[model samples]
Target: MPKLLASAYKELLLLTRDIGGLAVLFLMPLLLVIVITTVQDGSFKTIKQNKIDILLVDKDKGEVSQTIHDNLRTSDMFNIIEQSNENEAQKLIQNGKYQLAIILPENLSNDLNLKIAENVDGILAKFGVDESEDLPGTIQIEPKEVKLFFDPATQFSFRNAIKSGINQMVSKIETKSIYKAFQEEISEDSNEEIFDTESFIIFKEIIPNSGKEAMIPNSTQHNIPAWSLFAIFFIILPLSINMVKEKNQGTFVRLRTHPVSYATVLGGKAIVFLLVSLIQFALMLVVGIFLFPLIDLPQLNISGRLPLLFVVALFAGLAAVGLGLLLGTIAKSQEQSAPFGATFVVILAAIGGVWVPVFAMPQLMQTLSNLSPMNWGLNAFYDVFLRNVGFIEILPEIGLLTLFFIATTFIAIIYYKRKNAV
Candidate 1:
């Protein structure tokens, strides 16, 4: 116990003496959390407003085109500016004023009505009515298209949503047109029982999206966990370099004379770096939860999973320390450890989704991200911070990180024994 305490004291002395590295250990992540969250919070404000920039140009001088146009004018979701000229609408879209433009082609109503007349005539023939006498005659439709002009640069939240809305509007107009023809047929024949077009489609209220909306885009929810894991893993560079430097300088040689096993020495140093990692985690969380709200930024709502966060942080620290030990024991000197350790940490961070969320990555990248311990730690943190999940929900992540720590610990210890035996 005395030897272990001495080892820990020695470790802290080494770290405390390097004042600048110590500052980076604590302050850099705070700065990143604040900066990242600020940028993302601004975007969230726009999304919460739920407004769309739309330009509508209707060339068809008919009831169906006019009806759809009138609906757009009153819609709260669309901030539409109707233009009589399609060229003028195109100019506005190019100037970045609008994301989407709906161009209703000329003769749109005539083409749709022709299809409706053909359907009605078919129905009349089935019911033993003369198609020529009882039904409105069908005309040949000169096919024309409804053009959708959009600015590709505009940050349209849902591409499918805009398309779906336009489709629904067109369908409704076609339905009403067919129903008008059906009413004419009902007047001539006594079959109101089989065809009640007025009450065919029912409209239901769409409840607002639940707060569990995927990918809320809040920086506070993302930056804290992401940057915290990044900062923790960054400790590897210094930790591994210090180990190799001390070994090269004969510091380990002298320490071995003490009345303690080498494992005790290893355990003590791990404790120190692990504590540093935990401190980084706590400070980042504090800034996200308290300091951010004061600046009108998002609150770091942990969603009542503090214990799960602690468990994740604990395993994450162990994984980082184990990785550091492996690199330090394998490297021959600071020259070998410094660049290699930093590069290793950086590559792991990149793959682990410290800069981007794994859920948002390409399918192949998401699969690759699973190989990184940083990803496991980050996923666990996201579960606590974003998903409002309990400890049970994060058990798999915690277990994976724990196994990673155990595996690296064994590898590092085996290498250390081999080096010492030589």
Candidate 2:
């Protein structure tokens, strides 16, 4: 207990003396949380902000053309500005005021009318009515046409969504046209239904999550966990540097002669840093809760599984501590240890999705991310924050992180014994 407590106090005193390191421990993560949260907020702004602005030129001035315009406007994904001339629409697109332009030819309505006429006559002939071609005032009709002009810079997903929506709208109009023709020719007693907007079939769509809207992601959910995990791992650099410093000063060599065992010495270092890490986790949550409102971001929300939250934090801290122990024992000098230790943590953070969401990563990279302990910590936090689940839901993540701590600690202890034996 004497060596353990003394080592813990020494670690804290050494950390307090390094003002610059102290700033990085607290300030840098805070700054990054604020900045990255703001960026993600902007990047993921609601579907309203994601809308593409399109200049719509309605040269046809027909019902079908206006119908398409109205449908596009109804969707939150598009902002349609109607214009009389294609040239003006193109100019507006060139000025970058719009990302897309659509022009409908004047013949769309006329062609549809002619098509309906032909369909109507054919149906009438099926009932033994003839001489449809002999009808007066008829002219050859062409196919309906509309032209889409989109900026090359538009996102493929967005551009494709617009295209698919328009295609569906056109199909709907054509289906209705066919239905109208059938109604004129079919008997009242006939129950066949190709298009029944009123009675035969009512279109009802079931949205996911039982029609409950998905929660839009907020800054706190991400920043709190991501930067907190990152800051915890950064313990490596300082812990490694201090170990190298003690070895340089001959303190490490002398520890061997003392009655204290190797496990006790390493345990003391782990205990001290684990406390520091727990404090770091609490500090980030405090900043998110008390300080976030000044900047308009929502505060961090802790789940009802309060003890389980600490369980996640504890295991995450232990895993980081194990890494620090390994780094501290392996390197012979501060110069050799500190930079590599920090860089290694950062790389883990990046792959583990501290800097970005795992969902956003490529398929192979997402699979690789699971190898990181940071990923386990993040999933556990997300279960608490996003899913609003209890301890049971995060058991797998907790288990993995705990296992990681044990394995790394065992390996580091064996290596430390080997190195000191020489």
The candidate that wins on lDDT is 1
| Candidate 1 lDDT over residue span 319-415, tens digit each | 8998888888788988888898878888888889987767788999999999999999998887776666667889899899888878887888887
Cα RMSD (Å) per model?
4.2, 4.3
Q: Which stretches of candidate 1 lie over 4 Å from their true place?
A: 70-76, 95-97, 129-138, 155-158, 187-219, 333-336, 355-363, 386-389
What is the per-residue lDDT of model 2 for residues 1-422, given as tens digits with 9 covering 90 to 100?
A: 88888777777788889999888777887788878887776666644467766788887788888788888888877877778888878777777777889888887876886788777776676676654556545467767667777776667876787788788888888777777667655646446665675445558964343343333347788778888899888888888888888889988789888887778877888887898788888888878778877777676666364576678889999999988888888889988997898789988998899987899899988999999999999989877766666677798999998898888888888987887786
Candidate 1 versus truth, CA RMSD in Å, comes to 4.2
Distance from true location, Cα of 23 in model 2, Å:
1.2
In candidate 1, which residue pairs clash?
A: none
Model 2 TM: 0.83
